[model samples]
Target: MKRYRQFEPVLISGFKILEWTHPEHNHNHYEFIFIREGTGRHIVNGHSFPYKAGSIFLLGPDDQHYFEIEQLTHFVYLKFTDAYLCRNSSGSTSAIQQLEYLIKSRETHQMGFQLVGEDNAIITLIFDTLLLLRKDQIVNQELIWFQLFTVVHVLQRNMPELRSNSFKSRDLQAMFCYIHKNIYDPNRLRI
Candidate 1:
């Protein structure tokens, strides 16, 4: 098993798994899983989806989810706290807000999203950015922000059904507060 610790608030790691088993549980930080290759059964909030290549799973804070991977699998995961997302500029903040909306909509509606076509290239960039962020060097926050923006932009481009411009600043703040306060509660946000 491999683990990573965050000294700078966000942790990004990649894994190529021959075999993997995760205990049924949830986390306090937001999790983005980009599957480069594999097939599996993903069980999230009692809904199970067949996981395949190009599957992107976004698990918001404390969203009960786990996976059973059968056969070889390669994926990149990025985990970051809400505080980190909130620290960036308005556009970055809006992107994170959209992500939150997607997660909530996924959980509430039991919807799963798959990245296709040019979206794959954008996801690859996000993986590359994670690798760059791992190096022991003074990282340029602006560059990372740009990479993050690219990821969100691709997501927004590909998943227009999940996109919404109705989110306001107060809604973003309330969502963050709700996530922090009810992170461990499974019944907190029922569609």
Candidate 2:
């Protein structure tokens, strides 16, 4: 299996093709894949999930995936490095720890994000704005981070509700709820 390496901090790119040319591969950076159009099965770690226009997938560094296209597919990828995520917390070790805890959670991977309901419009707008700013080479760092964080919060909020059995311990469950409940308030989520 091939493992891809990304040298850039962030990247937003789009393409349309009738077939998936790349083999199943994992990358060093995190990825948000937006299915702009078409239909297909997205195979991730040997699991296949059907996808159509507006489907969005979040891939962590360890995830291996590829598309099995059934129709012409249009893809837009938002890739970013860990450094980009933790850039705001220059010297805060807990920031990185918290990021790794939430982002690397195995359960989160099981619930692939969607482009559904009101979130559909919000996410679409963010992507469109980011793409336009990226094209113009005039991205406002704060605005980009704000948009990305907003997307993350939306994903968190919409995650399927977990029962007591879902978590190993009561404390863990509480932490999860507290963290997600106050996601927009950084001070409240500080570890």
Candidate 3:
């Protein structure tokens, strides 16, 4: 029941179709929402976007957002903290790279069409990770890190547009800082 924040990188929350409705105005940690079935509309920063199966929406820290379900939807919500991303894994920073790009993008960037065919695989992986996280089994940190990277890799491979711009460490840090400062107050974010 801990609220998500930048200090803790992962949160596993599940929602059924009937539970879908407007949230009581709050910010997010790094968020990944996967719609397994049905359809809905996501309202973020005054914009209403359509959400169907396989729809993946990424919300950075402090981003005020919510969803209204139009059909029966099954989804998993993952929220991770920024501090968790800064930790280096082996020699590669793929997780950091993926997270930086995801956070830098606009709130609610769609990944693919409804959760069908290949997209179902990604959804399954996400659900699997959520279950693993919930279990809290004693395991190597590296394994957990790799699991996180895999999620990012799946997302990037699925949505080429999200991987378009290469980012430097400083740029990503600055972007995250800006998001942290303005996400709660959408009026302050010009973009």
* Estimated TM-score for each candidate: 0.70, 0.74, 0.66
| lDDT order of candidates, top first | 2, 1, 3
- Model 2 ranges with Cα > 4 A deviation: 90-102, 136-139, 162-191
Per-residue lDDT of 1-191 in model 3, one digit per residue for the tens?
Answer: 12333445555676677555455354545667777677878776557788886777777655566778788888777666655565544466656776676566553253333445765776677666665666562353555566666666676655545335444556888988998988989887776
Best by lDDT: 2
Q: How far is 121's C-alpha from truth in model 3 (Å)?
A: 2.0
| Candidate 3 Cα deviation (angstroms), residue 13 | 2.0
Which residue pairs in candidate 3 collide? 8-81, 9-80, 9-81, 53-114, 53-115, 54-114, 54-115
| Cα shift from native, residue 48, model 1 (Å) | 1.0
Write down the lDDT of every candidate, Cα atoms only: 0.69, 0.75, 0.63
**Model 2 poorest ten-residue lDDT run:** 159-168
- How far is each candidate from the true structure, as Cα RMSD in Å? 13.5, 9.7, 13.9
- Model 1 misses residue 29 by how many Å? 0.7
Give the clash count for each candidate.
Answer: 0, 0, 7
